[model samples]
Target: MSAKVINITMNGLPMEVYEGMNVLEAARIMGIDIPTLCYDEGLSSYGACRLCIVEIGPQDRTKVVSSCTYRCEEGLEIRTHSKRVMDTRKMILELLVCSTPGSKTIQDLAAAHGVITARFKPEHEDCMLCGLCVRMCKEQMMATAIDFAGRGPDRRITTPFDEASALCRHCGGCMFICPACSSRCMGPDADTTLCSSCLNLSPSCVEVYDHQQCWMPPGCGTCIRPEGDYLPATGRISEVKTEA
Candidate 1:
């Protein structure tokens, strides 16, 4: 079978790729690196981070756009890291880091771009609002247990009515896939919780916990408790009967 071809240019370098492939994937295949925090190979393009912005066009060149969401088209020209693009990306990373200072993903991205510190004060405690948790829950787990609750800055991840998620299988997939949760503790106690840092720094803890079953308590019942009986016994009668 003949493969479909799509001609494009990267930094003035002419290239040909498949018709349906995304610009970011095509560029990666061609050894072009576009820094991205929200774009994951396993998940769909979120385009929330806006770090992988690239200039694309031919005659009338368009403004810098996210390469992760943009598809490669015939005769398309892309500039992965122009001066303007780099500056914009840096600002974006700075803003994201300012919002979520504790996020390792944001810190790593900032460091990669030579950003020593965030310009603005930290606003949020956790969660960058990248929508990764919501997307993963819906798409991968096929459980619409939680989602974005509000709009703009007030937006947060939550189940319906901010209660325990019934649709959730407790698979912990959302927590596992979350970059924010990656660095937190997992046990009943916050201090004893297992985080990504704990896992990496103390690999032996995983084995010890597994052998001791520290994470899972013993004598745990999977079944639900039966409701209490309200009806009285057939042989039992009231000693002092009052007027009904």
Candidate 2:
């Protein structure tokens, strides 16, 4: 039987999506992109990365929810790139950068979300606890070779007793799926906690509205605000034209 359809609003536009479809799925169907790291199509939904968060419900009672794990409901209102949602995502990216300073995936995502710096001390650690490796090994590879152990800051993915697991076929699926496996081309030294080398342009839509008006990247170079001046009310992102 076909799934039931539900009505929902996203980014001020009404969408009819499957009732049990997650926010990410609904967004994907509408050609809307919501950035995510730990939500691979081959794997199950694991909201560990916190990158696909979106603001839901009315302004007075809005709540930030992970799109990968949150299903759409009737009459639900979701804003994928609101000021509050972007702020929360940027904060999460900063923390991820601190945890794994060498991950190219994390670094690129940070730059995309306008995360220029990380406040916490850089751990330069190998893992950000996304659990992709663990899940890949158990579910896809059919070998529970490694599992997360410990708690708090000490938590980690390791074989039982930290010994080499005999069941491991070393098919390299875990390493292949690991987002942190791709290290920054430059070294992750203390001096370079964040590799902003690839950073092109930060979004300026946040300065104008609570949510982004122009969703495109390097969008509307027109809104560059002076240090002591606000943009003229007449100068809007839509007024500026760019080459396609």
Candidate 3:
């Protein structure tokens, strides 16, 4: 085979792809549809969803593979969609939807795959651990404020020390990028006095710092502020006021 040519059979059709190309890209060029959720165009591939599963090799000896992360090799025979592949994809989607019942992304994917209902109860109401938030936080934003705090089913996005993310820049990037957390809400300004019901603070009127302080860089220390502390320079006090 030529250095620039990569021979592969996609869906039983002989295909030639560029060397060092991923299987998903090649299949896409051939107009083969591979359902994917965690595969972004610019970010590194993190095969978390397992929706793009395919069988590669001869019909009798083919093996299941993830098309997103798998590279195309010379003389590789690939089945873009097969009974086993579809069954695996369906099960993966089922589990994901069950884990995140309220997620629009999961619901849409399930509908596309013809999954009417999930077999297992939702492990969680949201957050499928797809890593889009984490990746965007690290790669695009260049901030390691938020991260996967735990392992397996207990995994959750959190800041260091499980407190408010002090290193977070309050950019709201993770909240925006996350498919599970795609919600937009408008509230009073940060300086406005909020009701007790709306304010979930402790007894000391402490403000939970969810991101890195404007004065701090690459550290969470500067973000720490005592409860009832007034803003410096502005002389805004946090005194308890009583209406006459």
Candidate 4:
């Protein structure tokens, strides 16, 4: 059976999309840009990062919904860039920066949204708690090696018991899927042992600390590039491209 289609109005423009599709996918099909952090088409819509939020409703009543996970409905009205939506997005970015000021991903996103600084004290950590790595590990790799632990501000991503688990495939999938980890190892740190290529014995080494471009040198260790589509800095793997 064919899937049903949904008709929606976005920013005064009317469009038709597939039923059961999320607002983000519908918006992208219409060329509307909705910034996101924890969204990947290959994984479940976790909605952990509220950056892709959009306002949805009628003239008198509307509410903000995470576009990545909010399924589209017929006769739905969406406002992607209203004052309320932008304000919410800005605040979300501010909080993300406060949590991970050292992350270039967060920094770049905040700058783009004119979030000059965080209102809260910044944590020195790089992980953004996006849950992409955790999703990939469990769903795709079936490793279930890492997950979010703790609660409130104490929550963080880590291996079980904070120790390396034997269930870890060591496939470097978590490092590759992480937005913070992508540019984290670009430098020649005193602790070179922390490098993924060094730890995995992969020949492809990325100079993340190089400051200009994240360059990957060949022949240091095996390099695994994501298949199907290519992304610049994030390097997230949607599908398995190669193993060597």
Candidate 5:
């Protein structure tokens, strides 16, 4: 038998997804780029990274939810690039960069979302605690070698008893899957936390309209606005296509 499907509206486009599919997977099917640090298709959905957040509900009253964990509901309306969603993503990127300054993954994600500066002081920590390594080890490698220990600032990934675990096969899956393990192009001692070298094109449609018309990976070209038309400096696009 075929899998049951659920219909949802994303970025004004209607799509049918497999039942129990999360918003992040649905958006990805439409070529929408939703940033995520903790999510991997092979492992279970752990909403540790809130980067793939989307705005849901009426325009006047929408709530932000982590797309990775939010299962699609029938007739559910989702805005992937609303003003509120963009703002929330930028803030999350800022915090991620602040926590781990040397992570190329975090820096690239922040630059893509137009987060140029991190206002908070930098901690220069190596790990963001996304738990990809832990999950990858347990789920895929079948070895619960390393796991998080402690609470708050004391929290960290460590082997049992802080010593090497005999259960570990040393398959290197944990380090291989870690985003923080990747180094930035600017090297470790760069004066800045954010490296815009891999910066993506700024999404202009979202600025003109309250939400974006384009949902491509870079999300800069192919806007819904007419080719020759431009919103006046003082005026914005008031018309928005929505789902019922």
Candidate 6:
């Protein structure tokens, strides 16, 4: 038998959706926009980025939950843009902005919420730890070269044991999937504003870019290299050799 449809109230608007449909999907179907950075339709819901959080339950006692992974239920009452939901999202965006002040993506997201500056001292980190690249590497691309390391304040994304792994296929999936760090690359043909300081000095390159290629000789015209060689964003010497 086919699954039964479920009725729910989102932002005071009644709607019907499939029994197992997630709250995010239901909201989208009803034209409710829920901001999300970590929830990609092509990949599993990791819930690492809490930007898509929504307020649930009756007004008396509502709680916040990640709407992307939360399944809809009969008579469920959800508020996608309630004051509480917007406050929580603003707080989350503030934290992300403090860590990644230089990230254009994060900055733009923060600007949308009217957050000019983070109250917390900026940690100067670029990666928002959204885990999209890591999940994409493990589930979609199947490279499994990088993962979360450390705990608490020191926690960060890195290749296994904080070193480049031999398993990386240089598919550039990690860079392509990263929302914050991937903004550096404009595509293969278009030049990017990438600099050697970002490429060699920062951990953002190792975490977001394919780790194997970050340590290799840099020749991409996007940055100033020692040899002045112009290469593609993939940082593949093979491409330079083949073209020559």
* 184: Cα error in model 4, Å: 3.9
Question: By the lDDT metric, which is better: model 3 or model 5?
Answer: 5
Please, what is the whole-model Cα lDDT of each candidate in the order they appear? 0.64, 0.71, 0.64, 0.69, 0.71, 0.71
Please write out the lDDT profile of model 4 over residues 85-173, one tens digit for every residue.
99999999888867654345666677788887567765545567899989999988999988889998798877788775778756766
Instruction: Show model 3 residue runs off by greater than 4 Å.
Output: 1-3, 183-244
Task: Give lDDT: candidate 1, residue 74.
Answer: 88
**Higher-ranked by TM-score: 2 or 3:** 2
Root-mean-square deviation per candidate: 14.1, 16.5, 10.7, 10.3, 18.1, 6.0
Candidate 4 at residue 49, lDDT? Answer: 86
Model 6 worst lDDT run, 10 consecutive residues: 192-201
Alpha-carbon error at 84 in model 4, in Å?
A: 0.8
List residue ranges in candidate 2 displaced over 4 A: 188-244
- Error (Å) of candidate 6 at residue 93 is 1.1
The deviation in Å at residue 189 for candidate 4 is: 16
Q: Can you write out model 1's per-residue Cα lDDT over 123-153, one digit (the tens) per residue? A: 6446777778678888888998888888876
Model 5 clashing residue pairs (backbone)? none
State residue 204's C-alpha deviation in candidate 5, in Å.
40
- What TM-score, over all chains together, does every model reach? 0.72, 0.75, 0.72, 0.74, 0.75, 0.78
lDDT per residue as tens, model 6, 63-127: 99999999999999999988988888999988876766545466567778877656776666667
- For model 1, give the 10-residue run with minimal summed lDDT: 216-225
Cα displacement (Å) at residue 170, model 4: 0.8
